[model samples]
Target: MANRFLAGYHAAFNQYGIWLSVPGVDVTASGPAANFLLRPDFKCEQIIISGRVAVAAGFNVDVMLPITVPTKRPYVQFGVAQSGVGQYPHDLSMIGTTAQIECIGGCLFRSDRLTFSNSNASGFTFYYDYLVFQRGIN
Candidate 1:
């Protein structure tokens, strides 16, 4: 389950009521934002990722694929990091998508490094529930 409630990610909006009317005429704009249900695809961004995973048992591993982030002002990539044994959850903030891509499966191959860069850079901003994978992960 996502942690939107815990993070208070609920929409923030403004409400306005128009004045001046004959008697019972009133109009309001932009009411309370509605809460939405998260979809399965939302759990893990349906990004096309391929990469190799190695196990000590000498078992055949698979590379899901690769995801290349387009370097823009804020370059972000989201996807499920497959693990052999367990499932990983996604951040609530990540669910509220700010970008839409029609071709979700695997993106057309591109260079590894991103090209989008901005000037007067102060710092980078990332929104997500950051957690360490593990200690043995090298």
Candidate 2:
């Protein structure tokens, strides 16, 4: 009946895999950039994050993948932010970053603060999609 169908759907969803998308991790003119933290229950060997970085002039943006461990936490640098065009041109750009980690859970994404303090740019937005793959599921 209906109960059986619901059970089957839930089983398939959990067994197959899971994906999450976080939009508009924004950084603004005032200050304070956005930070993203994945769930602690996340257990996977590899993770792929693809996103777009958009910002106004006078600011530089960079992406970093920070892996958590028992001692001595380190970060893997993706790339430095590129020079943005003026407001009129609309210099929105796309960035794709990936990280490979040991069989662990919980990860974080951090955007670098203002590289240049002169420009009065409006803001920045990082749209990211994260995918987690089980060890043998592919």
Candidate 3:
């Protein structure tokens, strides 16, 4: 498929490009692998994967991706979202939750997965929304 550029000022000034899946095509996961296979013609220099997961305290959560990244180390950004008394997104001044990518002693990333862990032992479940950006995809 051809790459489509954004219209208007951004396309003219920045040349921002976007890719869309072809119509009538199925990219869903199949078989034992359970990974969504990209179209053979799909190509891009960068891809962003975003999702939300609930992580239990003192436990690790692994998220599997549909694409195999070019490098084992990709840029990751994440944040915890909670709603309750004295918690974030509800109480603005509270520092109630903390999380981190387990890179030091845990699996941070593989070619197709990302692992996240938190140090909070309050027995509270944290809902984390993360974005994984990988460049050099072709």
Candidate 4:
């Protein structure tokens, strides 16, 4: 199972440049926000992301992933680290969420479009620091 999982992951990386999520680790989410260059051509069963980034309220943070790997519903998992200087850090996790995959051009795109007015009232940014994913049985 592990080898098969890695095979799928490697395939995704080679084809789409998407990286497997390392739980509790934050990747650089600066300039233009962070991007997972997932080409819609490749199919994936699941995607997991765990990381930290700061995006002002009303501002959008985008991450790309395969909504559906062929005909299977993609599962997503995330561990988010919300933090700021002098502010308490909080953790949030979404174990699994089935995505409704749709395509426009040739890519699967998803953006964190929620505006946390109360949280960002002080210009606090949302930081994610952990990510992990797995592909479904084909």
Candidate 5:
């Protein structure tokens, strides 16, 4: 309940970008869209972000955070992309359907619209910002 109060206050007072995301698309998130597996859900997920810059293709993570074990900064992990890899929608995707995947940049998503630039592996079909959240007590 305290967390809720804090979040509500922060959201109203802070000047940041808010986006919805798929649960487990990382460790802690909301979830995916309904029937998202079929089509590219035109739902704009809100994300709370600050100033964003662009980075070249690679592991150009904007920020690396320390992921704690529900307390006392247990383990170091990550947070949001400090820089924006993609600015416009067209920059990130070619078409709603499958395009010629050039970069096999690992399993970033589970859909056909999403592809890589030049990779040796296409592990998963990235449909959206898909991820498996840590359920129950980890």
Candidate 6:
């Protein structure tokens, strides 16, 4: 049984070694900004920013980032989800309530701040998660 297990382990190691020895296959999990693939045109610094904001009804708020945005208009991929009892981008008149939440702009990114606009007459807490990619600079 020990010999059989040794043989299986050896076979698995050989397969993994062959896969790792491939030219463009990278599986190094070195750092936060490490590229797991060998794509030359896909090397860019990225930062994940996430937060929650409570906006008053019919008001807008600007949330500051911990790090400065690399450019005036960097590539910001973001998502915002409503947490409170409100329907976003749709009128809640069918439910007999006028509380409709509107994201004024999908996601606005400035140099070092993110503007969140809530156009609802009822307050809501928004949870946002985004990835900021550094472009045009190595």
Q: Report the candidate with higher TM-score, 3 versus 6.
A: 3
C-alpha lDDT of candidate 1 relative to the true structure: 0.24
Q: Return the TM-score for candidate 1, rounded to 2 decimals.
A: 0.16
Q: Please identify which of the two predictions, 4 or 5, would achieve the higher lDDT against the true structure.
A: 4
TM-scores for all candidates: the values are 0.16, 0.19, 0.45, 0.32, 0.22, 0.42
Q: Ranking under lDDT, best-scoring first? A: 3, 6, 4, 2, 5, 1
lDDT of each: 0.24, 0.27, 0.48, 0.33, 0.25, 0.44
Return whichever of 2 and 3 wins on lDDT: 3
Residues 42-132 of candidate 2 have per-residue lDDT tens digits of 4443332323344334444443423222232222223223333322222234234243212111124333221212143344322222232
Best model per lDDT: 3
As a TM-score, model 6 comes out at 0.42
Clashing pairs in 6: none
Clashing pairs for model 2 are 58-119
Q: Could you tally the backbone clashes for each prediction? A: 9, 1, 0, 14, 32, 0
lDDT of 5 by residue, 1-138 (tens): 111111111122121122333332321222344412211124232222122223234432222211212221111111222223433322344334354554433322121111222222443222212122221121
True-structure Cα RMSD, model 6: 13.6
- What RMSD, rounded to one decimal, does every model reach? 19.5, 17.8, 12.1, 15.8, 15.2, 13.6
Candidate 6 local Cα displacement, residue 133, angstroms: 2.8
lDDT per residue for candidate 6 within 57-113, as digits (tens), equals 566678776655343344666555564433433223335446565644355788678
* Alpha carbon lDDT at 79, candidate 6: 58
Worst 10 residues of 4 by lDDT: 100-109
**49-87: candidate 4 lDDT, tens digit per residue:** 333455554455555442223333333443333334322
